[model samples]
Target: MKKHFLPLILSFLLFACGNPKETNNEKLTIVTTTSMIADVAKNIGKDSVSVTALMGPGVDPHLYKATQGDLSRLQGADIILYNGLHLEGKMGEVFEKLARIKTVVPVSKGVDPTFLLSDPVFTGSIDPHIWFDVSIWSATIKEVLAIMIETDPDNEAFYEKNAIAYAQELTDLHEWVTNEIASIPYNQRILITAHDAFSYFGRAYGIEVRGLQGISTLSEFGLKDRVDLVNFIVEKQIKAVFVETSVSEKNIKAIIEGCQQKGHNVVIGGRLYSDAMGAEGTAEGTYIGMVKANVNIIVNALK
Candidate 1:
């Protein structure tokens, strides 16, 4: 028990080392760990909540560490939201500290265990990339909506109204993705990427997915893993393998080179939004836009 709780102990010790910041009382300040979570919070909260994402576009949450500045922001926020299932592995201790004093919540808390994917490499942890499956992700909105209402009961009706609209958007996006991915030839539906971040996506869209690495970017890939994936691609004659915005491209590049060595020309389909979304002002920044962008790239290259 002591060994298991060590990270939380370290986090508490480090909290006193960071400088404090002034708290804003104008609106509900929600600090999220990833761009997708921030986008969802923004959609549900609308202009009533101010959100800050600790991890930016193309940032990998699995390897991200909390800086003193990040600590300050988390400490100052009225509500903290993160996609829990060990996605923010390094920052788990920090969140444990905040949970004691603030309204710290995991967006995945609302998802059913039956719908979650278990990590094959890890003993008990589940996959954290719920945003890929719009249907599973829609369940998270209820968690966010409930928090928003509880924190500010005066605007309960307003928050409820926005939650309904956001839920509908997710439903429509799920339908769009299902229909769009169906156009790909049954055999050509294999999706290869740097890591196993798209299992939910594959399950939802009926695509056969493979990754060189494990579910989390923290898991490293070996030569045997690379060679096996390359062999699979050569055997299957897969046209394109995708690069994730949040994961390193070196491994994917190596896979491409390996395929070339085997006399198979596998091109990079396109960059997919995996762990993180696109820039704030862009279409891909939003959850719906991110899914559509990935589907467009996958279908165009594979078809």
Candidate 2:
């Protein structure tokens, strides 16, 4: 079916399933585009909301296309939250269609423009990976809180309390990441990865970052880009290049081999959670835990 038919199909499904508002006897249902957003919503909404993430562990949101099941979940939800800033690049049309009938909010909307990073390759576009910086991600928590409170006014106090507690944890996480990344020798504080997902992390933690691909993993790097990156790695004697959990390891592997060809041996550093988090029930599963995991990996490899 044509992509524009999503809303029409969703409408038919909703009609067949009965009105969600009149049914849905459980807590408020929230459907988020990424696991990171789901984690934040769950923390803020707590027991007051039932949350589900369309993308799972190691799923790249940039190229993700919503399946028919996802449409149903989204259509049935009381709130639909996404990273926005074109993070869910392929699902924009679906979101636009759903917005007409229900509450579909971009959690990034509340973030100050001054705090956003520009996409170098795409002029007039902002990088969508704001969650890499714990401080910036904390802003999204407030956005989720505001929407939840607005949608369920009776639980305003409850949502506010949860947001306050989550905010403090994020504050502590930001400090911890800063100190840990600082431990890496200043010159050795470079993070090379498959794609440019960690620019916010590097900015927040004082590390220099390079990626083979552009901000989006879907953006390809040509032979010249690879050669240049290899030359830089060899010249700087960079210890390692990391792979992303969500992106292919092929690009990083190519970088490592290119360095070796020039007699500069570089190993694959531990994989980092870029666009996605770890599986559910794991330490890296939650937003804070994922940040800590990445910090520990970078510090251990680069320090």
Candidate 3:
């Protein structure tokens, strides 16, 4: 079905939708790939732009495909913001077609390539989970700020003020995460999750990290991978391993069972928000809130 949707996007591209920016009274319609990007856009574009996210809570962007309605929304949007670096792995063609006709911004564009972590399994590709590190994620806010201001210069001052405040909030969050993770003794700061999404988090906060699957959930893990992970858990005597909200728990459960067979009682720490944020209107729905929730979960479980 998704293979068929790309051709439909080409057709949608042929028709010109009404440009909301041309009118003075209407607000700009912003469509985002993930809720994390939508939350930031909403905070900065507040009351000035109408923002909508195509992928909601628990939706894995790695495997997510655009729908007919999503194509319609993408066609109608004034600007489209997405986390590039192949995070939205299945929607590359959709973004390419949309880019020719509208303002499509990849928030990760502002991140310094030198600072990016390369994928160990997939050569030449970098990790897309920049949001795990609050400081690094601020780079994305800058990208959004620049794009919003470029598209709507009239609100340049407003956007600048909002971006500054948002940046400071993230700075504080980064500090808090550093201090919180420190509480869990250095030797015990091992964060094992369902996938390699938290490599940035571990690097930024001084914790060792491991994942059953590779960087992207789309990658598969075989029996040997599971056996090695179970052996590592038993050897390290690690307390708990976490499952991601956007990923399947079957893998983690199997790891726990494997640990049990070796007399190591490993528990599921908590469901951490990895590829996606929590449901809308909840604390974890927002990026900052999601970070705080994850930090708290990790600290409580490990400490």
Each prediction's number of clashing residue pairs: 0, 0, 0
lDDT at 162 for candidate 2? 68
On residues 194-258, what C-alpha lDDT tens digit does candidate 1 reach at each position? 99999999988899999999999889778899999999999999989999998889999999999
Q: Compared with the true structure, what per-residue lDDT tens digits does model 2 show for residues 1-303?
A: 222222332232211111123233469899999999999899977777899999999899999999999999999999999999999999999999999999999999967688799999989999999988777777787678778878886666667666767776777787788889989999999999999998888887899999999999889789999999999999999998899899988878988888999999999889999999999999999998998898888888887
Task: Give the alpha carbon lDDT tens digit for every residue of 133-215 in model 3.
Answer: 87777777777877887888777767666666666677678889889999998889999999999999988889999999999
Worst-scoring 10-residue span by lDDT in model 3: 9-18
lDDT by candidate, in order shown: 0.85, 0.85, 0.86
**Over 4 Å off, model 3:** 1-23
- lDDT, candidate 2, equals 0.85
For each candidate in turn, the TM-score is 0.91, 0.91, 0.92
Q: Model 1 compared with the native: what TM-score?
A: 0.91
lDDT assessment of candidate 1 = 0.85
**In candidate 1, which residue pairs clash?**
none
lDDT at 31, model 3: 97
Q: Which of candidates 1 and 3 is the stronger one according to lDDT?
A: 3
